[model samples]
Target: MPGMGFGIRIEGLSKRYGEGDTAVDALKDVNMTVAPGEVVGLIGPSGSGKSTLLKCLGAVIEPTAGKMTVGDEVIFDNGWKITDLRALRRDRIGFVFQAPYLIPFLDVTDNVALLPMLAGRSNGDSRKRAKELLEALDVGHRAQAQPSQLSGGEQQRVAIARALANQPPVILADEPTAPLDSERALAVVRILNDMARQFQTAIIVVTHDEKIIPTFKRIYHIRDGKTYEEAGQALH
Candidate 1:
């Protein structure tokens, strides 16, 4: 099983752009941990270093100094220990953006299966896995539909399935429910919680949407490039 260790861990993580007087500190000694099978919320105002933190965790950018561990592997210590960040991301981390960003030309099934295929799985096995995920997400009916043909909720569900396609230990979701109505937004969170438990995937949802804030069992609030944790209503 993947994610055998703690899902994701960061200690003294900091990111700075530029130098000297012009230097901007986007993150300051940030610390966080997400256990396997847990879903947590990351809430912050604009310019609170939320995006920077996400980039660091996603391996899109490097941190000036930090220690990070994904599952049992320590990927960063002062600097990156892994040479192939792209492959690390592909095999270990799943991302769900605000938009579905599904391929326009590919049908829903292909869109979800693409990740596993890129990871070198056989095409047949990849499509089979995608179909199973679609069925789990209740979007199997739309497997043959194009992205443009699905409703906003359907597209997001497909996106979630794609993110889980690799069975990555962790999932990073950025404003995933921002475009949906309150009803749909909560439904999406419910689905995330279910997926997290089912796959033992640690999920961090970054959002400012007040509609679903109270649903999390724990919330991390970031401000002035720092983070603080608080208990949530745990509505789910």
Candidate 2:
């Protein structure tokens, strides 16, 4: 039932650092919208505002100005509307980093299940949902294995599964395929695409990997704190 409204929307978003005498603008009037069940790409070079945009969307940092809406609610309009940012991040926004960042101490199932568990779901229900996500991601056979025992691709898949465990309306993936070869990178993108469609989650993958860049249906290119939108080949 998540993603009931527009998946993610941003308008006139801007972020500034420091005081007026030494202010640095990291984002300038950026606007974007990602619909439910869509997979889009965010591409930019170093110091190009991609990180700032991601942090703002993830609620890790606040923006100087603009609006952000997710699903049916407006999270920010010039300021944060949600008081419980921790719960918002935990329950509504999922993150996938370049590294797997799995809890080395926990098995695959537990790693994926922890999000829902923290969100107040019963352990039994959380683990069941985790197992189902693992099966969907093709990592169900390794449910009992620790992070160290899995390959890079499998670890990424587990990370993806963890991101989706909360059924968040929006997923933010940061350089997810930077560590893989062409084949494995494409495989990861395919899994992300499948997951987006299956769950009706809007996904934005921030990546520099050229191998999978051409696979996006749409792309947002950021440079000098501004973004340009373009269409890409919708490769499966």
Candidate 3:
């Protein structure tokens, strides 16, 4: 749904572990929305519900209660509205983990093309699309290089390209630059902002990295099962 004027919409999203007195509420009636082409940061300290919220939104775990929509698809409502979360995740959402996690044996192009291939696209079309994203992300020159041969930044970029391979409406990036230096971290953030704008993808980045925290226009800080939305100052 690129440039389709649609994005993530969440309401009363909640999650809990266990039950009754032993239950721990990881999320508490959370509500938020992100527009198309927008980028926001999700920040919180250890033991907070940052990961819990991400898991809920990513469809990795079911919420105890809530509603969620990825782009135009209502994936969850009280319970899941869709039977196949894996398909929804693959077709409508994208994800970037703390590490690039690129397959060691695959070259950069194959690492990205793999997702489309899994989705049943032809190898030629998948590789063509992969090359386009690699070029857009400025990693085209290294398309033939194996993951083992790339720098930290290059690996992260490849991971991002893979996430975009499906042209998903939303992308969840969990600590994407945690392993990079200050300069490299900032570079990742800059690239994220640019890519969100270019592709009209809504991006939510979960991170504890202090260096790029203030760069977000808006930040959702979760603590003890609650969330506090705050405005952030831009970096120079």
* TM-score preference between candidates 1 and 3, better one: 1
How many steric overlaps does candidate 3 have? 0
lDDT (Cα, tens digit) per residue for candidate 3, span 1-236: 23555589889988989989999988999887777787888888988999889989988899999889887878899999999888888877889999999999889999999889988999999999999999999999999999999999999999999999999889999999999999999999998888888888899999999999989887888888787888888563
Compute the lDDT of residue 94 as modeled in candidate 1.
95
Clashes of 2: 0
- Model 1, span 1-236: residue lDDT tens: 12356889999999999999999999999999898889999999999999999999999999999999999899999999999999889889999999988899999999999999999999999999999999999999999999999999999999999999999999999999999999999999999999999999999999999999999988999998999999888786
As for lDDT, the candidate ahead, 2 or 3, is 2
TM for every model, in the order presented, reads 0.97, 0.97, 0.95
Q: Candidate 3: worst 10 consecutive residues by lDDT?
A: 1-10
Q: Model 2 — which ten-residue stretch has the worst lDDT?
A: 1-10
Residue lDDT tens for model 2, 1-236: 12456789999999999987899999999999998988999999999999999999999999999999999899999999999999999999999999999999999999999999999999999999999999999999999999999999999999999999999999999999999999999999999999999999999999989999999999999999999999899797
